[model samples]
Target: MEADLPHLVAFMLGTGVRIGEALAVHWHEVDLEAGTVEITHTIARVRGEGLIRKVTKSRAGERLLHLPNWALAVLRARHAAGILNDPVFADTRGGYRDPSNTRRALRTALSPVGNTARRDLGLSLRTLRRETGMTRKQVANHLNWPQNRVELVETGRIKVDHELVRTLVATYNVDLEQFHGLLAQIHDAVQPAESDKLAWIRSHALRKTTATALDQAGHTARQIADQLGQAKVSITQDIYMGRQSANPAAAQALEHAFDDPDLL
Candidate 1:
């Protein structure tokens, strides 16, 4: 999780800025005194130029965002650290962080399993979904796999390859951190399956759980959108440790919903 951009993740949740826009942020744009961060440019990968930080496409994309308290704290810490890099979120080498690598790192931080994937999606009868009271047949239907396949997976009669992992992710509707630790464990078919992380949560644990949790808490669609910086409601969900934005109700919802800090 530390290797991933937890701070940047927090900033995105608070500002609703696109990943590129967030990456392009310079020290000059972040006004901690004003509690604001301007979205002036977005980072793009040109064919030969590597990363190109350019002005936003339109005036709308160039809007200024107010920072929540927690997000401000994150910035303060960064500023106090006196990072030599121009970009607020720089790579380990103090240079522009590639969008692809950053995204991958964020996915990695998310624990795609939160370390729970080792069991949640592994061969275990006591997996997360089943422990939540979901029957094998129900899960099978969700995966569009034969019921026998679910049993096979649980019985350790078969290995869950990358395709199955992707299908499970898509079917379960979880983000990176939920499956964060899974990638390392995914290919380790020999790794013994223990308790399922999916076993812990209940009531639609998979499939838009993040957004649904926010909605149930009474956050508006717009707020959810801003929190995720996404137009789609299905995946609405961020963090300083980045701070949770109080102004936007979604930020508060996220703060309450995600148990793990990195999940934000």
Candidate 2:
């Protein structure tokens, strides 16, 4: 991503706040000297209201976050360059950035060829959901999905088809071919742009990275939860925390199971 998006990504990476929350951040909410930013609002597009600055998604999403030095440097540079009272990451016109469009730009930057990778597909679906102003949890509850399944689908780990998209969008039986045609058009429209090496990175990935870093640094699950504005530590542990890649100890335990003398 170009221009201010890199700074925005860095801010999100440091703070672990949701994309909407990051978009809604105003200069007034930031305490540069204190190295903290209050999370009070989030930007979302309402059907008739256009872009509205609303309260945080959850009460716990309103916690204050301490900025790392690098994030603070980003804020300082922005503060020096930007007008006061505007959003910390305002659009070119100095208004809130639409999450849908931002996500599309991100996808295009990552895969400028418009190949429509599984991650892009997930992001496209995510854009659709954001357009409808529905949270992942709400969608999961509506579809009777397991708690983490929505997140997994949107992360592109699970294969998705247009049928699933139609179902999730809550549309009546219609022409699936037409939907495919429209999706193709959307893919064609994403213009490629310059991006950093973390082209595959999305905001949620940054949050998970931050959480895993905190865990490695000896922070408790609750501490990470607080930093991430998650109400439940269990959710933090289950969703944000990354699993160890090489479980050598577990492997040894498994091998030991075969060492039992008594054969059943």
Candidate 3:
């Protein structure tokens, strides 16, 4: 990352702002004099329509954020030459940047040698289901899961976990080669970008880092949660503050006990 890209990434890391919120920011929303930014809008890609400016995900997401010195400096430099209604981060055509394309750019910049195997696993699944004449409800019934679960998985709203992947593979009756190919594509799509020693860093990782740093600096969970625009402090504590346990001994013990042929 260079030029405005580094500053953009740093701004997100510093402020814990989501990429969509940051991309939707306009000069009017930023007060360089006050070192603050109002986050009221977010850019999202609607299915039929193109990228549309929408309200923040929740009321909490519409709160104001105090800019750190670095972020303030960035805004100050931009404000010197920016128009009132222009986006803080503009596209080549001087319009709002698409968050999805921004993510692709980040991936490409961090990894020059792009992964050729990358595929739209979610779209592929959706196409497969449609080709098989299966509605979301029918697929959910086959998988013994909620219809919303099928919808979310197909729409990429929910991450496809191992059990879900296995279930889909079985339901689709994919051959070995197709199964491995689909698995590879899903793995690439779901795994974070790991290039240039960034260590799987994504926009959300920066937000989590901000929350963790705040917690380490003796800030209360409620304060961190507020800064992160979370509805509850427990979410900040459990997910972003690194307070969740990661012990895998239970899984290992279960596998050992159940996988033994003698026990069976």
Candidate 4:
């Protein structure tokens, strides 16, 4: 029971559904055909009681979301194991899950995997979701939310979009699918390719040579500098690098100057 809490919480994390939303999720809210979940209400702790139904945090909070394949698998698996109906995560008494108990269960569940915070701490699971690159707004959009609601969710002070969440995951080269498959590949395949590196350097050299030739062709150093937006010393360094090539046109143009008084 305790060992399964993180797996339960992982569903919320993967989907970016709020804890309250996850707690309140019932069979009626899901549409297997459409692959979506309708956000209606949530279960929250108001007083000293266990779980109570409450209105969603915002009007934007009440929206529909397309369920990802990964999320659906977890949901389907849990449902198939007799976790359907009134409360998706019911306690042993067959009532709503207690928030305190849920926290303890989560702590216990995360321990075997070595992937949770201190049990006695004040950290909200939402913060943990963000740290783990999961959050409500992010999950909602992946499920195809209303345009107006999606806007509010992304830029809203309270929630962030799924794309933003994906962006965060991308920074770590993580993919939610199969968890760390893509991450492992990126880590393993990220060595610098010497051939590609040399190709890029050669391209830079050609560009430098072209720029210098054009610059030496009666163009002022400042004009060339303005064109490339580089320092004059940089131009000098390119010339020093032996990138200057003899052009027949430039030599022809210079040949006339060698015999003319105006060249002086």
Candidate 4 lDDT by residue in tens digits, 1-264? 533553454345333455566667677887766656666677787767646977776543565655445555667777778766577666666667665556544433222211111111112223434676745566456555533332222222122234544554443345645445433433322333322232222213333543455455675443333322232346565455332111223322223323333311
The window of 10 residues in a row where model 2 has the poorest summed lDDT is: 245-254
Per-prediction CA RMSD (Å): 13.6, 15.1, 14.5, 28.4
TM-score of each: 0.51, 0.56, 0.56, 0.39
| Residues forming the 10-long window of minimal summed lDDT in candidate 1 | 235-244
Query: Over the stretch 1-264, how does candidate 1's per-residue lDDT look in tens digits?
Result: 355366786677556567788889999988888787877888889998998899877543665666666767778988897863788888777677787777645433333332344444454333555556677788888768865666555544444576776665554554534665666556565353343333333212321455576678886665554443443334322221222333345545545655454543
Predicted model with the maximum lDDT: 2
How do the residues 47-139 of candidate 3 rate in per-residue lDDT, one tens digit apiece? Answer: 999898899777667777776665566677666655334788888678888897887566444443223322366677887778788788888
Tell me which residue pairs clash in candidate 3: none
- lDDT for every model? 0.61, 0.66, 0.65, 0.46
Clashes of each: 21, 0, 0, 2
Error of 4 at 247 (Å): 59
Tell me how far the alpha carbon of residue 59 in candidate 2 is from the true structure, in angstroms, after superposition. Answer: 1.9
Ranked candidates (lDDT, high to low) = 2, 3, 1, 4
C-alpha displacement of 61 in model 2, angstroms? 0.8
Task: Name the runs in model 1 displaced over 4 angstroms.
Answer: 1-4, 112-264
Greater lDDT among 1 and 4 belongs to: 1
Candidate 1: what lDDT? Answer: 0.61
Candidate 2 to truth, TM: 0.56
